[model samples]
Target: MATSKPQVSPELSKHYSARMVAVFRYGSLAIAGIGFIQAVIFAALGSWVVVAMELSAFVGGLAIYFLIRRGHLAFGILAGQAALMAIAITMGLILDVPTADAPRISHLYLLVLAALGYLNYQRGKSRAQLVLIGLCLLAFIVLASAPLTSPFVVLPDMARTIGTWANAVMATTLLAVCIHAMQAEFNRKDKFSRDLMTALWNDEFQLAYQPQVDLSQNTIGAEALLRWNSPKRGAVSPVEFIPQAEELGLMVAIGGWVLEQGCRTLAEWSKNPLFRHLSLSINVSASQLMHRDFEAFVRDTLVKTRANPHRLILELTESVLVTDIDLVIAKLDGLRELGITIALDDFGTGYSSLSYLRRLPIQQVKIDRSFVQDAVNSSVSASLVKNVVLMSRDLGHTVLAEGVETIEQHALLARFGCIEFQGYFYGKPMALADFEQRIEARIKRLA
Candidate 1:
């Protein structure tokens, strides 16, 4: 009973790049080790032809390792997995004969290759990756049932028996490693989902308002950005957690809380002369908008907080329109009935259909930061920004350019007829109290 130790190098790697490097580094070594061991066994069995095949695996694996270390990540992954599949199939057909006691187990490595192939595809979507995965799966199934008649010298009975046990041990060990890596990611997400629910209940989730300003550089409004300071994980970016929340079906609840808090803030602002006219834009996820009672929820929050509906802007991304355009429009119309303004956020980043834009009850268009940042250098981006401004304004949508980080970018956006803006150039997202104080100071200076 020989137990094989599994390689789990990616257990502690956090970022995707780090995980990728760790997997490739360890996976390549493991492959090479398998090849080396098989080559030694076949050499002892006097299977010279099989020894050459095994040595090829050893060399191929080592080549992939060097390629990966040299930063040829994509090529390394594709070549390594493909080579692994070829070797697995060749060896399974030639030597791994299924017996009553020793079943054909070499083909089992194909399943591991399939898993790795899927992971690679997930990292980067490509047709070649899909083909590799399909080949692995097909090879696995076909080889599991029948082995082709080998022209090359086959392994002896004793060698087949030893090889079966070795293959079973190694294949299962590698398979477990893949499963553990995948399960680790799932477990992290599960833990995050639970933590998110607790954070919602404990009021750990917060909204930081990034100021949106007019051309006059006066603070006119702000977008409420979600932030979380987990006691266990420290401060987690919305980039990392928002999509998770959406996937876990928790965004609706989180959105409701944000709406409530935003409305309350609006109500408080209404009492201040300077802040009375300032609008607050709160982002609405596709799921939140599609929620059957989203309109009623907003109405209830408005009624409860007595927030001025005119001062509340719900920012919807272009991606949301892909879900159900008619339903989205209906929801927007219903929300509009409450006097809450609708603003399309992250413009030019998704499917922006003229027909859908014409139908959506939107009052504003936000130029995504990518365009704004690149507008200064790239003519294509600049022209796109200019055209988006013209088109959005033509549709009577107030255009706001986001991610304006410099005075030069700000000047370019202003020149392009985008009057309203939101970005770090004006002010970064800050606490509500700080935002109000900043706004107050600006008002004093204007006076």
Candidate 2:
């Protein structure tokens, strides 16, 4: 792979990072603030020791926040908080912070702190951070329970009875709060992810076609391309987002949608006898091919749009062939049986390029743009294209040279026995309606 310079603006990247930090800091502060308020209320109700413990926790949290802000905090912040919690519990026991009337509140505070520590640990992105947080939470839980598990049971006194009831209430409240917090976080993250996808779907992602003309007739034969649009970002280039969508598991849906749209457009165009000979080609992502229901989806879309399967060409990248040679060949064969022509896109871009020619059920080879762009200036590139074209011809596959941006380049390709060409020299991509008008005008002029 070619190593390219970073494409994102440095300022934008920095701003994004800063925003994430702010969210993390504010989220932590909010949790601490709630704990502090609860402690104050409990203290006012005559549970001074519990209030003191809560205050200590609040102070510890603030210290952690500062350390994080300064970029000096280690993963040990969780451990440190757990230690402070332990110390608070010990002091409470020594002075009897929870009276006979409210032993339950003290237990609730300890349990809630432990739960918070556990959540902090689980939220850490790295394994090291997670382990540190887990240990801290564990320590807090152990320390908080040490006194309560003492061998000597307090006599069945009023103070003991009140403490037991308070502890029960505190446990119930803590459990409820933790459950609500977790549910809210899950819902928030889910909504954010869904919104991001929706925005991407509506954005300026679009398909551009390279006309595949027949060498014998010198007329436009077909248009092969895919569409992608993003709302926030304008025109996310396929070369940039295709791989990302595959990695992020969004390609199947996107690719299927593109297929349906392309087929429907082709069916609409086919109504004109002038365009009857012009085929439509759509690129399929590896993720889409790997889906168990892909073939069925393609069949259903073709039926729904009433598009001729023979006129719909499906293009697959060489990367897909490389994934599992036998599987790809089998899948291509299935598509071929449905009368859908298969083209190997970006033919020479991957490893084992020559191997795919013999193994896959490909009917056409679209020479990658890189070779076409360099063919005019470099003999090596020219020779590579010549060999690929010759090889495809020998295998009874049609060859289409992509990115033919100059007349000289077009002339050179023609000299090398290359037939079909598509690039900016003819015309950049236009809207479907504009393209149709151009086609009509060209036909009229020729007539």
Compared with the true structure, all predictions reach lDDT values of: 0.81, 0.63
Error of 1 at 36 (Å): 9.2
Q: Relative to the unseen true structure, what is the C-alpha lDDT of residue 345 in candidate 1, on a scale of 0 to 100? A: 78
Each candidate structure's TM-score, on Cα atoms with residue i matched to residue i, is: 0.78, 0.56
Clashing pairs in model 1, backbone N/Cα/C closer than 3 A: none
Q: Which stretches of candidate 2 lie over 4 Å from their true place?
A: 1-196, 200-206, 215-219, 222-224, 227-229
Give RMSD (Å) of candidate 1 vs. truth. 7.5
After TM-score superposition, what is the CA distance of residue 140 in candidate 1 from its true location, in Å?
0.5
Off by over 4 Å in 1: 1-106, 117-135, 149-170
List clash counts for every candidate, in order: 0, 16
lDDT per residue as tens, model 1, 170-205:
889888888877766567667878998899899998
Q: Model 2: per-residue lDDT, tens digit, 107-202?
A: 344555545545444343345545544554564465455544332223234444654565456546655665566666557445544644675566
